[model samples]
Target: MADIQRLSLNQATVQNWSVKEAVDGCVRHGIPSIALWRHKIHEAGLQQSAQHVRDAGLHVSSVCRGGMFVAPSAAERKERIMDNFRAVEEAKELNADSLVMVVGASTEVPIADARQMVADGLAELVPYAREQGVKIGLEPLHPMYAGDRSVLNTIDQSLAMAAPYAADEVGLILDVFHIWWDPTVFEQIQRAAGRIFGFHACDWLVPLPDTLLGRGVMGDGVIDNHALRLAVDAAGYNGPIEVEIFNQALWDTPGDDVLNKVVERFTALV
Candidate 1:
């Protein structure tokens, strides 16, 4: 059986649940951790959301998310960095393990320039995150999302981006749905030993339903979640393994039912 104590329900997995509802669901289901989204936090009010999780004694694995560094203009990029400063503040308020980053991609600039923007944005935000006692979890999306979702799409790229910072200040968030196809993923996971701050679990649907919302639950798709989980664990990261599926079908399902299946599949598959 998977280690139930290490499971975290990323709020996106239960897209329909309010912050209070998500916290209560985790409590009722014996889930020890949760990853909160910013929009939901705003909906519930950050202070109240923090209080609810604290009262329930649930660990905040991460705050999703804080990066959208690619923009057309320098001023816009600065604005994006300013927004990340706020995200760091929110993570600090929740006492989250890290502020997860889905670094942005853009067609407005060359891909090389966009990558540089991400690096520059990180340089500006990491110090603020460090000052606020928050870690920045850089997540690389699948290459399919490279045009719009993120320019950082490989463990090698993310690791290089994080190399200049201290492990605690900036680290990688590995998601099976995103990195499972990479030929060098296991090698990179080992290379990421001390800097793997977060590990997310979910599968990639065989015939993708939607590029952005096609993630399947642990066993519902093709990913080797158990092997990936083992690799992440072997990399010296004993943190929460978050369930972060984004399928619209799962979103339409009742939150309780989703959590039920998540726990079942996680134990049996992940």
Candidate 2:
């Protein structure tokens, strides 16, 4: 059996639940860790959110995000950088493992220009994040989301973006839902090795749901969870395997039930 201690329930899996409720549910379910979203933390107030999680004796595996460097103007890029600085501070306060990043897209500008913006933004942000004792996790969203959600759309691309910095300062987030389709995934996982900062698991549904909200639970879709887990383990990552799904049906279900299914599926597959 996979160690239950290595499984974390990402808050987005149960979006309606408050931070306190998610923490309580994790404690009740014998889940040792959680991945929090910034909006949820804001709703509870940062200090209160940190205290609540600490008081409950739960480990924060990671904080939702700290990216989006693609902006229209210099002034706007600075604003995004400042927001990322705050995210790093919040992660420090929460004692999180890392701050996840979805480097932004280029709808109007050239893709290369957008990528340059991300690189430039991280050049400044990584140093500050390092000073604050927070690691930056560069998550490459799927190509389907490349147009609007993220320009960083592959494990190798994220790794390349993080290459200029030390492994401790910048790393990659491997999500099955996003990278499973890549033929070079395992090879890239090997290359990532110690720089693998976070691991997220969610299967991709077939008939490919028209909406991005159609993620499937583990074992319910086409991903080879066992292979991916083995590859990540072989690449020297033993961190929490976070279950981050965006299914509307799962969100509508009772939070406890969603968590139960997550645990059950995670245990069976990963």
Candidate 3:
């Protein structure tokens, strides 16, 4: 294992783990950080879950999501914004390093328009998040998901839109699974600089099936995760290395075992 700090688990990677189990899993593996989805804390309730993590002496890297900003009705948009407010509150509750935002896309609207909707939602949430002392980490899903998952689809593109809301309060998550093939990835890492709040790792399989679940385990696919982590480190990011693989095979296993393997691989790779 590398002496440098390594291996944080994003809750989705071990979705089968309860919030309690996940905290202990990380503690047992000697991982220093973690990121979580709202669903987990909501299931466990914020206070109890947050206490367990703190008691275990672990760092909460970021909360998994916010920013489903595209909607047909004003009411729906308001609801999404409120949900983000609650997510930021959860970040506060857990003392997370940041709150991860997945700015959603609307196929019915033009990509540009959808992105603007995201900007609007962030404008509304960023101030409150800043007040609560939670940094917003925007994750740019790959261009393949621009139609359904996120309008902010590239590192440079996401940073361009997200930079305005960013103070000490908000930043970006650079994920190799999402952006490894991006032509500008090298430069954008430099551009993101101090603003890169988190780093996620996984591999992209060649014959990608289902467009979503084809995420390969760390060494199983073609991605250069080592190079990606090095780029993140070079960009002046000395924070958590979050493992965020959304693969079907791993999901079928017990979450504890999955986490153990992830720590094992992350130690060897990064």
lDDT of each: 0.94, 0.92, 0.84
Question: For model 1, which pairs clash?
Answer: none
Misplaced by over 4 Å in model 3 are 1-4
Candidate 1 per-residue lDDT, tens place, 154-235, comes to 9989999999999878999999988999999999999999989999999988898899888899887889999999998888
Off by over 4 Å in 1: none
Itemize residue pairs with steric clashes in candidate 2: none
Error of 3 at 39 (Å): 0.6
Measured against the true structure, the TM-scores of the candidates, in listed sequence, are 0.99, 0.98, 0.95
Question: Candidate 3: TM-score?
Answer: 0.95
Q: Which rank order by TM-score, best down to worst?
A: 1, 2, 3
Cα miss at 162, model 1 (Å)? 0.6
Stretches of candidate 2 off by over 4 Å are none
Per-residue lDDT of model 2, residues 1-270, tens digit only: 468999998999999999999999999999999999999999999999999899988899999988999987999899999999999999999999999999888687688899899999999899899899999999999999878889999988888999999988899999999989999999999999989998999898886675588999998889998799889999999999899999998889999999888899888888
Give the best candidate by TM-score: 1
Give the number of the best model, judged by lDDT: 1
